[model samples]
Target: MPKLTTPISDEEIRSLKAGDTVYLNGIIVTGRDAAHKFMIEHFIKKPVQPDEQELYDDLKELLDGGVIYHCGPVVKTHDDGSYSFVAAGPTTSIREEVYQADVIRHFNLKGVIGKGGMGGNTLKACAEQPAVYLHAIGGAASYIAQSVKEVLGVYKLEFGVPEAMWVIRVEDFPVVVTMDSHGTSLHDTIQAQSKEVLVGLIS
Candidate 1:
């Protein structure tokens, strides 16, 4: 399997193709529906307020050349106030279809990890921004958590565990490239082929 790391370069992202298995290392960020909407509405689209400027800066620093995981991880809190992931499975990426493209561009993201693939907007954003969409095993939450070496930090805890933004460090995190930076999508091809097969059977 190919290896990927945070702060991934444009060259690295462009070299990936659909169907390539990869192991991701270094740092990744987590977000879901609420986080996505917050990023777009509060951070990216409008002017940052005095109170939010700090948050905006922090997000910029964290997200630069990083990977975003579409996950609502199960976390455990220790007595020392430290946190750990119990299960970290990829959520259905289509939920963020409305905001992903803008998020990628605004954050300079290189990769996205999720299941069920994304749509045309995200595909176009991938092509334009030279990013890749990686597919993690949906049912393999515990296995995925094994790769997360540390829980670096988190933001927006108000949204609760599922919607909070989690910053994590991972080692040899496994995923498959389903959408490549070159505008190639395994999901799209599979869907089209499936439709064709259905039509043939009906004829």
Candidate 2:
């Protein structure tokens, strides 16, 4: 497991190939369907205040070749008025198959994180955008949640926790690289290889 830490840049992420293991630290935003829709619908051009713009600006440079964790956490505030992650499970990567590639390009994002592989559209998106896809272990909610150290901000809280965008700081988040910038997919390779071996054995 590669120990991944803060101040990560786009160049660093692009340099990584498929099949590498990474332990992510620092901050990453969490976004899903509703949050995605809202961001796309925000046509107001209201000119965000300086403080508000800071997050996205920082996000751009760091994410220029970094990853997005597709997680919807279970959060409850503490008596001290601080929040924490309860269950930080990876959402199915397929749900955002529709918007992922486009989002990756729009944000200049380098990689995406989720569970259960994504299909060809996203894989193609990865190829075109030179983005990569990462897989988090499914059902390891509590273990994964431990990595979330803080929530800096959130968007669309009305959409509830799962559908909202959570801007969080994490430490030592575990993930496996499953897709490459060149469009080579670990899932596809596994499926095809599995079939060939199974057929050979049956014959």
Candidate 3:
């Protein structure tokens, strides 16, 4: 399997193909519905006014060139108060379809990881921005957690543990590219082909 790391370059993303198995390393930020909504409403939708350099800088530092994981992990706190991921399976990605494109453009994100597939808008954004969508295996939460090496930090805990944005460091995190920067999507192809097959059978 090919390996990728955080701050992934545009060239590397372009080289990826749909159905490629990739082992990801380095940092990734976890975000689900609430986090996506918050980011879009506050950081992306709001115009960067003259006095808001700090706001822009903060978002850029956290998201630029990073991979956004559509995950709400189960974490455990140790005696020393450090956190560990007990289970970290991917959430369904289509839930964020409305906000994903803008988030990708605003953050200059390199990749997204989730289960199931996204819609046309996300496919367009990935193509235009040179990003890729990696699919993590569903129902394999505990297995996935083994790849997470460290809990760097977290944000927006007010949304509770499940929805909070968790910044984590992972090593050889496994995923498959279902959508690529070349405007190809394995999910889309499969769906269309399946429909055609059904039509032929019924006809």
Candidate 4:
């Protein structure tokens, strides 16, 4: 229940433990499996397109050093070339294990936003890279989408919607950082501690 001062740094996130709370007011991005596949396909091959960097860069600057949410929002594009988000459920964090570390490293991201906590490899990657993992509240995508008032833009039509990169403008998106850069995972640690205590009393 400590008070956090201004400009919370990467080092500060490492010392945070389970049940610790933080208030953040920074930019965050949304990406999912489609986006990941696109990145990996281009990364593995020569390149998906000559302007791949441009595709990523167009919205990445706003995302770098900020959080990236693992979400593939269901949006409705209007006839006038505008769109509105209908549903925005969070995708599983485990699915991103393949490239989460790479994306974090490449973009120098500060934190990751998703539903469930990731595995050991991701935990270690977070520690070494000085980033954090966040858990979003479930069953609240409709409310969450309301927070997004405008659609800034989209990237890579070749990938298409769901896979095509999108840039949105949100009013106040809510989230919580559940893992930090010091190998502290709220999900892992809590499960272990709970199991030990329950077994001890029952035995």
Candidate 5:
């Protein structure tokens, strides 16, 4: 199992092949539908507004050679204004397909974590941007939360806890490289195989 740390280089990302089991040890941001849309609109499609500059700068730095998780985690807020993960399962990734390719290219992201793999645009971005899409196990929220070592900060709490962009530090965060920079997509392979089997049965 390859273990990768944050600020992973494009070279490091390219070394990974589809079906590789990997563990991540560093910072990752949680972003779901609202967060993805907001990022595209505020940071990618248009000029960064004055008030959004800080968050934009922070995200730019963090996402540079970094990873984003398609997750809406359950979290607990402490009295000291800190937070912790209660459940950290990955959400379906396809919903972000509209914006994910651009996000990867714009932010220089090396990896994306989620379940239910993404579409062709994301696969192309992964190949062009030298990024990979990692698949986390679904229905294992509580189990996955155990890998979340700390909550560093969050943005857009107004989007609600799940849709908020939560910065988290993780250790031994397990995932599989379902899509690779070399243009291999496990999801596509599976779908093709399934379709062939269905056609064979019907014929």
Candidate 6:
């Protein structure tokens, strides 16, 4: 399997095709619903406010040529004020479809990790921005958390743990390319094929 590490380039991202199994190694940030909306409204749709500027800079540095995981991890805080992921399962990605394309474009993201899949807008962003949608296994929260090697930091704890953006370093993190930069989406393909089978059965 191809191993994707930090500083991943657009060429590297575009080289991946749907159904390819890959291992990711590097810094990734986890973001869910609240994080996404906050990013869009506070960072994308409007100019960054003075209070939010630091966060915007941090996220911009991390996300450019980096990956974002659609995860709301169960975390364990150490007595020393550190954190670790107990369960890092991916959340459903479709909920962020409206904001995802913009995020990818604005952040220069190379990949998106989540369970299930996204929609046309995300697919278009993948093609145009030269990014990919990586599918992490669902119901394997504990197993997935094992790949999280370290918790670098976090943002927006006010949104609560689940919705907060958790910065982490991962090693050999496994995922499948369900949506590639070439406009191929396994989710769309499967749905179309399933529809064909259903029509055949009913006819």
Clashing pairs in 4: none
Candidate 1 residues lying further than 4 Å off, grouped into runs, are: none
Q: What is the TM-score of each candidate against the true structure?
A: 0.98, 0.81, 0.93, 0.78, 0.98, 0.98
lDDT of 3 by residue, 11-90 (tens): 99999999999999998899999999988877788876666567457658867888999999999999998899999999
Tens-place lDDT per residue, model 1, 1-203, is 68988899999998999999999999889999999999999988899899989888988988899999999999999999999999999999999999999999999999999999999999999999989999999979999999998998899999999889999999999999999999999999999999999999999
List, residue by residue over 52-171, the lDDT tens digit for candidate 4.
666656545755666666877888989998988887757788888887887777766777777888887778878887887877777688987887777767666456566556666655
Error of 6 at 138 (Å): 0.7
lDDT values of the candidates? 0.94, 0.76, 0.92, 0.70, 0.94, 0.96
Cα lDDT tens digits for candidate 5, 10-73: 7889899999999999999999899999999888999999998999999999999999999998
- The deviation in Å at residue 70 for candidate 5 is 0.4
Off by over 4 Å in 2: 41-66, 197-203
Best candidate (score: lDDT): 6
lDDT of 2 by residue, 1-203 (tens): 67655555545666777788998888777877775554444411244456557655655655665667778889988898777889998988887877777677767676788998788888887777777787899889999888888887776678897877777888888888798777778998999999999999999
| Per-residue alpha-carbon lDDT of candidate 6 for residues 133-168, written as tens digits (9 for 90 to 100) | 999999789988999999999999999999999999
